[model samples]
Target: MNATRIGAGDRPRLYVSTTDTTDVTGDLDYIAIEHAINGEPVSLTTAEKVYTAQLLDSRGLTPTAIGRLIGSDPVTIRGWKTNGWQPAPTGRPHKASEAGRERAA
Candidate 1:
């Protein structure tokens, strides 16, 4: 599935209203994605993820740079780019805390 555009007059970004793990039957609005970079676990709403990806893209920041900015893996950041803010696929199993964030609802 592709992304859905967010509100107007805000930074242009796209979010997944449905995903591989989520569909119209569920509402995941309260769920937040967190990634520990350095020491802090940065929390981000789905919109934040989209904005983040676009922000980095607009600035021409590579995945390495964006990974450091959000405390995620560079490969994961690249996954976000390809997945378009759905979730950063680590290409490996995620820890318990890292689950759910991979797919937005």
Candidate 2:
């Protein structure tokens, strides 16, 4: 027997199979449940900050080159060149104490 399991959104499907010729003593055909284990979301702000940092570190690339590579605005790149930015916080949140952000600078 063959079984297929679907997941939410654009997640990948899971497949399983069993046969009497195979290990029949165990669970036969099983429909494995699929879910977003350790689900997390990306922050576009963080992505922009990371991309800007990478562009700054590339050394050889001009603003236009970096913008084309990342499909962003050259004006944005120019702004980043002047006013640095930080990546947006990920969905995971923690207390300031837990994150060690409360310590004296």
Candidate 3:
């Protein structure tokens, strides 16, 4: 059997900002990026998060699809989508964007 391995080239290079908004190379989990920075006050900025969400919304995709499209974790995409601004729903796996996705395909 041939085993597939993810080398350094296959992994994503994440850059978390410092107190002055400078990019620093690090491998922080995609989902915890906002918590690490915002919770700890590490140069607070929502530019990337918001931008990613906008792209996903414009493309009419769910967090899973957008995550795959941008090489980000699906949970992180969901985090950006429902981040503090949006209201949470009780139902699981919301299909609000699913219809649009089918149309796009």
Candidate 4:
């Protein structure tokens, strides 16, 4: 991961400001979303997605909202919740990397 990439746990829930017209956290998320929508190479790892999914779930955001933010569907988000946000096995064996580490191919 890049040193500057926003990790899933990095930002707090966006709060309305009393005087300012801007919410930094929300702005950052929007920027990321725009970049992704523009077909940029920004990608979140599965672990990152899991962390964010759990965070959003805890914040009471519905599956649709969380899915829009995280670039997944409501079904997948619900499945992650059912599995406790841990990566559930797909029942297929993982491929071995050149370093002999098992990873999704």
Candidate maximizing lDDT: 4
Q: What is the Cα-based lDDT of residue 93 in candidate 4?
A: 68
lDDT of 1 by residue, 1-105 (tens): 976543334544333333433334443322232222111346755445555655566668777776665556777667677886667543786576666665543
| Cα-based lDDT for every prediction | 0.52, 0.42, 0.48, 0.61
Compute the lDDT of residue 88 as modeled in candidate 1: 50
Name the candidate that leads on TM-score.
4
Task: Report clash pairs, candidate 2.
Answer: 46-88
RMSD, one per candidate, in order = 15.6, 17.1, 14.5, 13.8
* Candidates arranged by lDDT, highest first: 4, 1, 3, 2
In lDDT terms, how accurate is model 4?
Answer: 0.61
Residue 2 accuracy (lDDT) in model 1: 71
Worst 10 residues of 1 by lDDT: 30-39
Q: Quote the lDDT for 97 in model 4.
A: 58
